[model samples]
Target: MSTLAYGCMGLGGGWDNNPVTRENINQAHQVVDTALEVGINLFDHADIYTLGKAEKAFGNVLAERPELREKMIIQSKCGIRFADNEGPKRYDFSAQWVSRSVDNILERLQTEYLDIFMLHRPDPLMELDEIADTLSVLKSSGKVRHFGVSNMNQHQISYLQSALDTPIVVNQIEISLAKLDWLEEGIMTGNADGRDINFTAGSLEYCRKKGIQLQSWGSLSQGLFSGRDVSHHPQHIQQTAELVRELAYKYNVASEAIVLAWLMRHPAKIQPVIGSTHLDRIKACAQAPLVTLSREDWYNLYASSRGQEMP
Candidate 1:
């Protein structure tokens, strides 16, 4: 399985109304170079990221270095539209939107076809048949090689997959030491207190059993021990940071490696989508694959993160 994926959300900095420029493109190239140096070959993008400048900056890299295209797996997502004066921010899974989004993504990424394409989020108003047909057309036309979804639950993925011949290969969701809901839902299962766990029941297990790739966002938990003052952090975060630091010292690696190793220790073979733009941070995160947490240490970190013992 792929060890990790680089997220382009932070590329082409500044989400203000400003348009992406050559400066952003240069910045993206630097980050991409650093990520490649760290052996991360998968790049993740969303149309709404940095107002679409993320893709443009990344595309600019490929335009300048066409050879880089074959060395990487580029994936992007669409269907999230901003709120205008007309209405609130919403999702669009309409056939027209999916078709047009793929075209725009290819143009911005300076690529002929995407290795994978995913819906940015679940579209409650989705017409499954229409979406299935749209995806069929895109796949048959050689626009997208594979399909996936982000922030979708098991039932939603099942329903969508049922209507399409192409399989949903990945499901990206927020998972980290700081975010315990994903694991808490299962750890607390069979107990009445588990009712409050809002994560979709059996979602993690479903993905694991179906061989669906589980890619995590916020995999580093926003830098638990990145020289920040943990005193001001929440009690649970403070505790988790302390434990991570201790484990890092014990394992002779950076704290990021400890956190990511905890997630990687799971049986699901999760591929974390790391968004760090700092070269040093990327290098530190690359050490994640080297750390092997024992079963006892892994649960200790989990209990520390959740501020309680596992059920």
Candidate 2:
């Protein structure tokens, strides 16, 4: 239950046209070192990042700094399989797959157990009872301490929880000023023009009421806040920049900090999973917990995203 979860995606040795090398590993070490210096107690990972290269890369660093292991919480996700590089993707939630995945994670992370283990994404065909049974076994064996899901909706969460004895601790999703559908309606709410489709409804409020923590992936909007044209959608880009600037000035921090703070400001007590390859950006995200935003500011940004004032 770290206040902020620092993502290790970029550090897993890819993105930004940066080749994964010894220098990259050294930079990752530096990033982790900086995160430690700033009191970032949680490190977030996924089994599929960099095609399973991320965990091994992080393992190298952890092996070197064995002493730092006690000071941090490591969480990794499983269940998504990228057998084909082009991605006719598959998901495996069977007990056997879950057990094998945990074994691989432990070996790659160079750790005995994970503080939190999550299903990377909800499998449409998954059997809740089967998945839950696997989690039970893992918990009993000390392979995973807590259980949760990523990219899941309320119904999906409920389906899994219904058959499981373990408490679903958190739901990690894409939530940002740019992606606010979960706040307005459920994830099933979609726009007619085949655009502006939302998938989760009042997800923030739901998690709050249920005592389920919310973790945000793509906290920087997939580098959208970095002033890059991720989609070439002019309006989206304009709105993101404007909101980032306004909030930055109000908070007296970097634009990225405002974005992170907005998610952190929610009542759900969100822990943003920052995916930055640069050490400096990672350090800036570590400062997010310190930025406090007023209710009005949070709503103002929300309105900007919607392009209308709240009723």
Candidate 3:
């Protein structure tokens, strides 16, 4: 699989009841072309993105170009439910819901099997044996090839894995130059200030030790250090942006690439999910793999983003 994935959250128009327009499908086609041109074979989706229109739009593209399916690794997530008449918006991990969600996901994606099927979030009321049985059935029936999770802590992962017949292959979380909690938690371990960090301690290391892939969502940081205006921002952000631009110029890649490179430079081999719908920005992000930051440069960006020297 490619280290970078094209996120389909921006596809199929807005989050309203409006039906998908032909323009939406055309836009999906363009995004697919650009991502494939840049060697991104992994396409990520969620059942709730644009109320399922994102997957529908991509399915339309695949329906037209059936050959494209063979060239891609498609993964979609479930377990997140929007508020409906029966209940408030919440995560559902029940056997009935998981089975139905996988069916819906496959139907929307227009695929016989998903390369990966991930639980989008941890459901507090999830029954380990029940959910594990549901996933096992999906895999046995050839609806989903592998399983993963997002936004789960180490303890949650371990408890769930205890009942699973197969290994969890991926853990997606918020990891980027802008979101430093994953890194900060590690460096702040055993310090009084570490209590303020929100990340789960040992989560990153647990995944690494178990050989689970660490995927990063929100990896671009909303163009914070890339090209967005930051004049009114704090001095640390301004300095980070300046440093990112300098590195981009030196490496002959986009500032977006530099930001992503900083994350990719880690030994964990984090895969960044690029959510940009713009062609230019997508192209800019593809250049990330081409530039490898030096050890000193990596620390430089990390320290600059931290606003102070590391302890």
Candidate 4:
């Protein structure tokens, strides 16, 4: 496996509001084509994307190109519920809800089974045994081949693992230069005695140690690096931009490649979920696998983000 998965969040919502655009659909198809061409074997998706519009769009693409399914790994998440123009959203991890959600995902994607299905987020009121039993049934029934979770901390993962027979394969978390608290202590830094350190202790390093793939969302820092200027941001963004520019020139590639390279440089083998809606940007992301940043450069970028040298 390439250890790099392409994210399809843009297909549902995020950029523009044109889900029906022929140009957009064609661009998505082009992304798939490019991904396969460049050896990207994994595709990340969520059921709540654009209120399910994203999966429907991708389903159309898969239906049109049936042969591509056999060549790629398709992963999707569920458990989030949205209200109608009002009220707070909710999460449901009940057995019935999970079963129905998987069925709906299969129907929307026009597929019989998903390679991987994840709980979109940890439900505070969820019963570990119930969730595990549901996943166990889904796996045995062939509705899903694997199970995982998104935005889950170490404690949540440990709790679910203890109740489930299956091993969790991946932990999808928000990881990027802008998000590094997970790499350090769980403390969010700057706050006194904070409970949530932005992530759990040893989460990233633990994933690296345990062979659980750390899939990075917000890989491009929500397109912050794509901007042409960094004057309004902190000095770290500027410094990182300079290093990215330097590496881009050396590699003869886009600055995005440097950003991806920085993530890839980590020992954890981080797989970035590219959120770009542009075909050209997707292609640029593909080039990231080819660009190799030196240890010094990688640490330099890291230091810039940390605002200090590594001890």
- In order, how many clashes per candidate? 0, 6, 0, 3
lDDT of each: 0.89, 0.79, 0.94, 0.80
lDDT per residue, candidate 2, 232-301, as tens digits? Answer: 6667457767777777877777777888888888777888888777678777777677798888888777
Q: Sum up the clashes in candidate 1.
A: 0
Tens-digit per-residue lDDT, 1-311, candidate 1: 24989999998768977887888888888888888887889999998888888898899999999999988999999999899896799999999989999999999999999999999899889998999999999999999999999999999999999998978999999999888889988877788988887799899999988889999998987786544678987897788888889999999998888888999999998888899888888888888999889999999999888887876
lDDT of 4 by residue, 188-210 (tens): 44446445565666677666666
Per-candidate TM-score against the hidden true structure: 0.97, 0.88, 0.99, 0.90
Q: Model 2 segments beyond 4 Å from truth? A: 15-20, 84-87, 186-197, 229-236
| TM-score of candidate 2 relative to the true fold | 0.88
RMSD of 3: 0.8
Q: Which stretches of candidate 1 lie over 4 Å from their true place?
A: none
RMSD of 1: 1.3
By descending lDDT, how would the candidates be arranged?
Answer: 3, 1, 4, 2
Estimate the lDDT of model 3. 0.94
Q: What order do you get sorting by TM-score, best first?
A: 3, 1, 4, 2
Best by TM-score: 3
